[model samples]
Target: MSADDKYPEESGRRRFVKGVVGGATLAGLGVAGTVSVQSLTSASGIGGGPVEAMTIDRTGGPAPYGMPQVPIEIDDEGYIRGVWPEVDTEEVQGVEVEIAREELGGLQYSQEWFQYCGHQSYEGLDPNFDSDNYFKSDSAPGYDWQADVKDEGDRFHIDDFDDYEEWGNDVGNSGVGKPATATWRSEDTDNVIPVVIIRSSRMEEAAQESEWLDASTDEGVFAFVNKCTHFCCVPGYKRTGESARYNAEDRVYCQCHQSVYDPFNIVSTLYIALPRPQD
Candidate 1:
């Protein structure tokens, strides 16, 4: 207990001072309330929104120009699904789909598309299935859309209906009608989900063009059914090769679990059997 021992060495005193100063500096910054950089990166963590929230533009309805909408198909029941709309089944009919299996570099590869994969149609709706108020297509000309489509005859195609057309139809036909849920792979990438087209029976009924129109009333029913068991996902329907555009061989395909269903017959088991909500 000497005076030198009680006073401690100069070096020890300096160390104590430094520690105290550092603690005070940190306290002034409110370290307890400060957030970590790692937490900001996480979605549910502290501070501002996560990385996706930072990058996502949720200000208005459609995203800013040049920003991809991140392919997401929301079904009538509000489920995330996928679908392809490349081929209009009403335009193509009575097709045969083929499947080829190949192994490359020790990796197995299966070729699938609309006709061969499988499909579910949203039929029993109305003529001009394309025409609807909620339907939005940036690609189609003038966007001739409709809530319920009007049969314009064989000379007309669904693609011919644009958003503007739909808007006009919406004005003509009031009330909010639900849009058909569809999903499909992006033609932009190979890894993109697979999608196909189901040729509509209406195409076969083309022979009955006279039946489509009746002198009874101005409003007529042109039945267009979508066989997709799931509401929101895209009906697997497309061709793989250059010759497959409008390929009759393509079948229904599921991009989520790589399930392939037979568009023609009732498939109890396929890739992964998910519950199909009854209509």
Candidate 2:
């Protein structure tokens, strides 16, 4: 099915949101609100939410899927060794690395599935459930649920789908219409950071207004933390006019409470307003 068919119209979005709210209440959980930076980092999980043990597809046999080594060289001290426009030297204490288009094709896109009906199972949620294996470590032998995310991108391309046409078709179990994400280790802090990259043709206006340093020069690559400023639920990207929460244009949307953010604008004002309930 096309994205239009998969993602409902505005009215349909209202129903979906309503269903989600009702389901959460039934499950004895409340919607999360704004959160602090400290709390966000400490959560160590996806969007400061609980981590669930997910099953892996050991059947396919593990293919090579980990942080690919980039041209950005890291020194023995773990600092990036070159100067690039994409990196903030002050932040990383080394040369900033710029992610090239070719590199993006090799990187794995992050996926997320929402099943608000309380029906819990790996099936019907994710197609490439094993794509998230990178989040898990050998020492920790389970799915790192916290690792699945779609929020910010640094010198990274953010879009509704990781590979627009491919993901739109739901190939490789790519969570089409779901938030697509990628991650890299910052040479500066030596921390693995998740980012959302947008290359949508329709997001020019929003990108011009974003906080991304290179938004002006780059093709709308703005990176930020994947956590929602409010309550920290992993917000997913919705294509322009896909749902009621994103009635006008493309945006980052929080399923928890229907909070909508502009993918093009700075994160501070991205939260334009809350979606109004249908009367």
Candidate 3:
């Protein structure tokens, strides 16, 4: 590579971000490192700590890890919903604490995976937040076609994405996937959990080779938290034509910081999940 292709020296803040990214990459690689028990419990929350989570691969820019995958299930009625794991209490540090945790896709799936970026305090994160756990349409959607097909708060039906096999927009290539914007576990709550859903044949092919993907996704459909790990900014897949400049035209791109994530390269990411507020 030529010097012209290299990024210039970064400032202290950028250096710090890169350092954390490196550590997270190592953790995902199963290179065990030690963190003090005090550090894990220092934060003021109930369940924050190093959590094993399934995420879309972070291929470029400064995000420390991929966006957390939201395990989903399609109902008999053909509506899709995010899977909230079973709720129960566990003794941690000798005190009983309520948590949403269960084994799925060969992993300890838990609410801690979504406990970060201040989402730790969302009422919906409560193990028993009263809602059907369906992915509801956002009032303001990213894709124009979504607004045309469904109204705000309408549950998405699989038939809504019948064109996914040949879906196209002005942003990226055609037949990549069909996308949607929605909220999960947020009905009647002050805080909304932003979510992104995509239906693609590519996912169908990948799931065949991955145990985690097979259990978390269904019929080529999957969802993830829309927040970028870099700075909590929302990112989108094939939403911006400008992503071509960063060579991210076909991936989830965070315009705010030029981060890119590959949807098809899902991997296990060990990330520090923040704890929820005390009940």
Among the numbered candidates, top lDDT falls to: 3
Q: Per-residue CA lDDT of candidate 2, range 98-209, in tens? A: 2111212222111111111211122212222212211111121111221333223222222222444334321112322223354433322223333344344334444345
Instruction: State candidate 2's TM-score.
Output: 0.31
Each prediction's number of clashing residue pairs: 63, 21, 1
Which ten residues in a row are the worst by lDDT in model 1? 53-62
- Candidate 3 to truth, TM: 0.87
For model 3, residues 145-175, the per-residue Cα lDDT tens digits are 9988889999999998899999999887899
Q: Each prediction's Cα lDDT score?
A: 0.24, 0.29, 0.84
Position 75, candidate 3: lDDT: 97
TM of each candidate vs. truth: 0.19, 0.31, 0.87
Per-residue lDDT over 106-208 for candidate 1, one digit per residue giving the tens place of the 0 to 100 score:
3222221111112211221111223221122212111123213422111122333222122222221212111222222222222222222122332233324
Model 3: runs farther than 4 Å from truth? 1-43
Q: Residue 15 in model 1: shift from native, Å? A: 64
The clash number for model 3 is 1
Report the C-alpha displacement of residue 67, candidate 3, in angstroms.
0.6
